[model samples]
Target: MDMNEIREIFFQECEEQLAELETGLLKLNDGDRDPETVNAVFRAVHSIKGGAGAFALDDLVAFAHVFETTLDCVRSGKLEPSQDVLKVMLKSADVLADLTNAARDGGTVDESRSRALVKELEALANGEQPAAHAAPEPVAAKPAVAAAPAPTDSSGFQPIPFSFDDFGGEEEEVLMVAPTYSVTFKPRAELFSKGNEAALLLRDLSRIGEMSIHCHTGDVPTLDRMDPEGSYLSWTISIKTEKGEEGIRSVFEFAEWDCELDIKLAEEAEADDERPMIPVPFDLSLLEDEPVIGDEPHVEMHVEPVVAAAVAAAETATGVMQAAAAASARAEKKEAPAASAAAQANAANAANAAGQTIRVDLDRVDRLINLVGELVINQAMLSQSVIENDNNGTSSINMGLEELQQLTREIQDSVMAIRAQPVKPVFQRMARTVREIADITGKSVRLITEGENTEVDKTVIDKLAEPLTHMIRNAVDHGLEMPEKRIAAGKNPEGTVRLTAKHRSGRIVIELTDDGAGINREKVRQKAIDNDLITADANLSDEEIDNLIFHAGFSTADKVSDLSGRGVGMDVVKRSIQALGGRISIQSKPGQGSTFSMSLPLTLAVLDGMVVTVAGQTLVVPLTAIVETLQPEAAAIHSFGATQRLISIRNSFCPLVDVGRILNFRAQQANPVEGVALLVESEGGGQRALMVDAIQGQRQVVIKSLEANYMHVPGIAAATILGDGRVALILDVDAVVGASRGQSLRQEMSLAS
Candidate 1:
């Protein structure tokens, strides 16, 4: 295509390489000393450098070259991947990523940081120790040094020579003999159609060394017989280069199946005394005397002397060329088994990938999901219409509609599955965030991740990075204590933050737990009082004290630091998670540790909801949040004060919240006896009995974004269209529970008054 498209592909591959580089480096940091891992990391940097040079990205090329050099030392065992070294390498990786991004998008990286890292990398590569925290020196601009010289328009398919120096010792001493080879290349019509240019291949071939080329026009037809798309041109090239046949073959690897190629060693030059001097046809004037083979045209050339001499030379070299060919055949036979084995392994890998996955444009998948959502809504409407028209449930139309409903649900589920992706990449990104934050805070922290392969909807995973990053930073900044403090508290000097994800009850649950001094309850309480969030004598349980951190404008830090204490993150974290139809809660124990748990919906497109009527309006409650539904007995209902009510289930009292009242559907609370009690767990792990007017059947419903099309309604996650074509509000269970608690507290104060 165009150079811009090629550059875009190059950058996309750079991203994949960057990910691979980070993954390999993280593995090394985790104590994996596998030699292949280092090689893979080095290859990633090397590949990026090679491509950058092709595009003349000088800054990227220079940085990647320096980074690759240091990585090579580690790969060759000249440098050990000690903790200190790994720390520097990890920082260097981040800088490399920044450089790559800057190259792709017009931006600048922190030059001072990159210069310092380059200095450190150079020191490591030279087997010299670099001073920690050394001031960065100015870096001079460097020209792009490509791994292989770029081809010009005149030369084609230049092969880069592979070095054997890395093998070391005598292999480096053995100078490869430059061998002359005769190459015949005839491209098929498909070659040019596939964007393979003969001139480009010739230009690359010229990079090897000196070359002599002969164009054969004997196959060309007259104007009347010529076909524009037909292949008529062929070339015989003679080249002398130190690179082996494999290197030469690689030049044509892209079009191997699209052309006819034959390569063999050219005959050695004969001495003047050993052979008669023959005047070879070196110019077009000599071809005037040669007869062309084609029927359409004829050219006569007088080359009787040259032909006779060439026959004599060929006869003399017949034995030699035959021996060389036999030897080459033997070598091929010797390497056949190894080559076959490698081919089998690669084929198996390709087969596995082909069977398991396909790279599809995300926009296509999104469109498909939208279509499936529409199908689900249409099916629901049709089912409702059939039920309304047919009084008897046994009608054939009703049965067909039920079947259609089941099929639509299956299709929707299958479509959602296409958007589900494992959270490992996001978790891997968080690992880097943790390292950077730990370095900034001057704290020794280790992040341990588990169940990183747990799958969630792609949209959920994308939005989770922000909230997850905030939590991870908070864990390092606020939850984990300093190394000295941790040791003083009889804990390990290096604090551990455990990030885990798993599927729980049709939802994804992620937990970030830190092993350090837990929440200081007294400090939090006094801060809440000082901030006017609570009174001086406000009685709050430990759970309530822990949750006070999530309140807006809440912070317990004595002084603001770069990492935190601006009272900005925790509250925003809560709001963002709630907006995703997810819940975040805190669990802290004095002097032990604390865990922040988040529960999120599997997908934002649709949800399994329990339909219920509240204040004469239909509402859908997420089934994942409901533990059980029960009819409250008269004796089980108790009023603690004038307005606060509790439901006794299994001898335990749960705060009874009227859904209609909490959502402002009604001005007054509904009677507990007349409604069904839904025993649901709130975001904070507390159980509450939600009182609704009546229970309707459960169904899967498509979620429509109310906040996008209209203003966001509090206590309502989103709006959806029901089977009857009426709009129904989907309950934000956590928000409603939170609102109910606030109402209950206000009611208690009024009763005290």
Candidate 2:
């Protein structure tokens, strides 16, 4: 490909490396002292620097070099990974990510921040203690020792040193011996196809020591028989380097499977009396008639003389050849067991990845899902037609249609599964958010996450980030009390926030809970009255007072800060969630803490719904929201006021809401005794008996966005096409209940009037 494409691939890899870096640093911060973790973090930064240097991204290269140097010190155990040190590293990771993003997207990072972090990193690298507060625990301070000047490459960037010395002192001495080896390498066509350049490999080999190479062209064919993509050349090389045979082998590690390679130690000088003489296998005159391939005809004829000279030299080196053969045999015998073990491990890995995964663009998956949705709709229409034509349920056409419906449903489900992903990455991001916010608020807080592997639709996960971020910030800034206050309240000095996710029924429920002083009810109630949101002496319940926080422009903070209380309140969070067909609620205790729970549909494309008729119109209620359906008896129905009714179920009273009246389907409320009552739980964990005219069969229906296609209906989540080709509105249970409560308050006020 062209340079631009290569640059794009580099950036893509940088993203993966950045993620790995963050994950490793987080593990270390959590008290995982594994040396491999530090190595991994260092490697990520090193790789980024190498690639950035190639692309002329000087800023990225410079910053990453310094970061990598500090990480190298930690990797080598020269620096301890104390909590204070980890904190600095985490911030460094953030800054590195910012630099990467700025480089990719055409922007600039804060120079002041970058310079300050560089100073801190350089200090740690130089073995200097950090600020007093960040100093490691005192036992006895070791005298500071200056680090050796790191070796630099042609680009003037220092490479992290790697040596066998780290493994053992004896191995280091063994690595110092200079040994010569002869290598034969023949590339297969696949090597070049995979973007592995032979010239680049040769250049890397040249870096180790001196080398002489001879190219063989025996495999090349005449132009008529030539395949442009075929491999037609091989190379034999002699090299002497201080690095061991393992180092030489590592130079071709990436291409080993794509080439034929052999290596053997070159022979040492022998005494004059022991020299063996060998005769040339072919006469020099025999090669003169062979037609040679070269850039010019004159040059092509010179190949005969070159071949003659090479053959004569080989004859004089018979002793060296014999020694190389012996070395080859010994090397093979020594490597046999290790090679077998490697082969077995590779087999196991291949078996595990037999069903390999390939990344597909999300737009393609979304298109497939849309097509499946259309198929579901058409299947429903066909089933309806078949039922109408074949009046008898036992008809062949009806049975076929039923089978077709089942198959279509399975296809739709499979398509949706392709779009489902775990929320772990998003949750990990929240941990960083918690740290940054805690630093800003000057509070000691810890965020613990559970059930991060809960899978949800990609669309839902993408939209959740913003609202979840706001909630996490709010929990740190407002939900948690100061460290001193927490201690005074007989709680741990460091407040804890627990974030959890789980699949409940057919919905994904996420909760953010904090262990700190809970909502102050009196403060909230008085604030509501002072803002004219509620009348004085309104007699609001504890739940109602807590929920007032979600009202538009509501805040308990006396002044606005960077984190919250700038007129944008929980109401925006509620609206955003609701827009995704989700609901959020709050529960608070006096001194314990508060929990914000959000329930959202698994997928927005299709839903399992219970069909019901209200005010002579068919409507759908999400099956997940329905607790049970019951027939209301006369004795079980009671009227508390002109418009308020309650239903008694299992000796417990629940508010009864007429669905038709709430949706404006009818001007007057329906009689509870004549309609089917659906006992359902609202967002706030309150039960409500929703009155519907009758219950119909349940079915899967494709959801079409009402707001996008038309306008937002107050109580309707979305519209769907039914089997009879009629449009049905899907009820938003939380919105309907909210409307019912507002209606009740209006009636109470009118009564007082």
Candidate 3:
């Protein structure tokens, strides 16, 4: 394959292995120290090493080799997987990423950094004292090891060893031989002290045939400042050998990342030259044992395929047992297996055993969902058209159309459900963060997560990570306190950060609460006044003071700390949540703790909305924000001022806002006895009634973003296409009501108000 093809393969494999490594690391971090996870991590590194060797990418191969060695120690239990080990290993993974990116761009190896990293790896591999236990080793002076050979199994074909005396020879093979092959060599400036990696490649190639070396000094600068030991040169080699290109490529694999190299087969060869020979056919015998004779009738060897198939089939059967167990878990009694149910169970088991998770590109999933939403609109239009057609009121045709509409609705639901995934992964991520924060603060913190299985649209899940990270960090650094502080406050020394998620009234509600020092309202109020966020004499509620932390550039942490005292994380969380059509609220008690509750829409593409008509315009209010709708007599409305108003609902004066006027539409004077009042729940737990001309109906609307097509307009979340192909704005009820009052209700009730 050409260099470009090899590069593509390297990138693809690297990406897959990186993802596998990340997942395994996360599992390990979550306390899953299972042998499988360890083995998986090892396998990821091993595959990366193999791929690097094929591409003759020395930098990647070198890093993976060392990384694989360290993991091998862990796998063998010779080196304990201590937190320090994992931490260093994580850093090593980052270096591997750097090497990969650099190689992709055709850059020379970063020698200084590589040597430093290699020294660290050696220390880790040697099981030396961690940095905390002793001083770090100087990169140049650190002791070295000859390149370790790949471990031999029952079969031989041992990895070539590398040592410092043979680099010039290795450089010869890299340049003169293996010209048809592509070699990427990246050397640590200090690699010469440990191994003459280049010479080994030459020795390995001489075993096959004659080769030509072409050294290139393109990257070398003027000689004055150049360190002779540093690799200021790269090479392209041409070799004529019977050995396959891959065999020749492996010699420089370990140094691919640290040096620049290209190797390819020489074009012309002497027909009279003897063919290359191997002292021992290391892997040849293994291939010979399984030689293919014919498409069929090679039965002497192959019962294994049938047995493997049977084993897979049996695994699926076991999956059925698991599915049955799952179904029985939530049911009060055993459910009878109906025909369709049985088929579904079977299909599910087959799917499980097949273990083929359909990894759709996320873009494809989004497109599918969007198309389904359009289907829903078209379905609605069809239903509307049928109703309007009135074909002499034909009962059969009307009934058929209704059934078709129902089927279309079911299909839309099924498609949307495909995008829903349990929020367990995100919750688990936060749980890990909780542990990190606790360690940093030197405080006892136990994160208790509930409703991890609560499902949300994937789009919401993707955007949720940053906000959740900030919140968890805030809870750890600012919300919780040290053990001594907790003891003095009549709390458990091991403080608790409770993260709870659940579906509430068609929306997902996430609550992050901590049993530690709650928001210090007095301090917050004073800070707000000092910062001019409010006046000194302003009378604000405790809730409003708690929210000041969400204001940009506001932080209550008295001293800057590593986690979040610099005053730059929470406001972004608030804005992200709002951008997702969600609201965040905080509840706290002085000596107790604080709970931040965020209510988010279930899906970005669709929602159950209450349709209302006002001043010749139709608006859909997210049903989650609507408490109740009532056709109250207009006389019940009392004007507090020219614009301020209130309506008595359930013996309480709920604030009233005119939807038409709030949206800048022409307002009609209410017939003092008529008009509808829609009671809405504000984020602050306050109730408000929105006056509208009429309640049209309740239905699901596909939410289309207005901000995408136009700039963000307050009081409007998005616009939706109606059945008649007209556009109706989805009212952001919270923003509408808040903007009408010229301030957020939370701000209006601040302690400094």
Candidate achieving the largest TM-score: 2
Residue pairs clashing, model 2: none
- How many residue pairs clash (N, CA or C atoms closer than 3 angstroms) in each of the candidate models, in the order given? 19, 0, 48
Residue 672's lDDT in candidate 1 = 86
Write one digit per residue (lDDT tens) for candidate 1, span 1-753.
344544565576677788888889888988999987986787677667655644556678678767876787687566899988888898988988888899989899999999999999888877642443121221112121121132322332222111111111011111226787777789886785664656456656655644556544456554334343445667667777777678778889898799999877776332211122111112221111221111101111111111111121222222222322443444445422111122122222322232244557889998999888888888888888887887878988888888888888888888898899999889888978998999899999888889988999998998989889989998888888999888899999999999999987788999999987899999999999999888998888887788788787788888998877889888878877877777777888877889999989889999899999999989999998899999988999998888999999888888999988887789988788888999888656478899999998897899998778785577778999888889999988877787777734333222212
Error of 2 at 428 (Å): 2.8
| Best of the two (1, 3) by lDDT | 1
lDDT string for model 2 (340-418, tens) is 1221222223222223564578999999999998888888888888777877789887788889888998898889999
**How high is the lDDT of residue 502 in model 2?**
98
Error of 1 at 488 (Å): 1.8
Query: How good is model 3 by TM-score?
Result: 0.57
Order of the predicted models by TM-score, top scorer first = 2, 1, 3
Off by over 4 Å in 2: 1-6, 128-355, 630-657, 664-674, 681-683, 686-689, 737-753
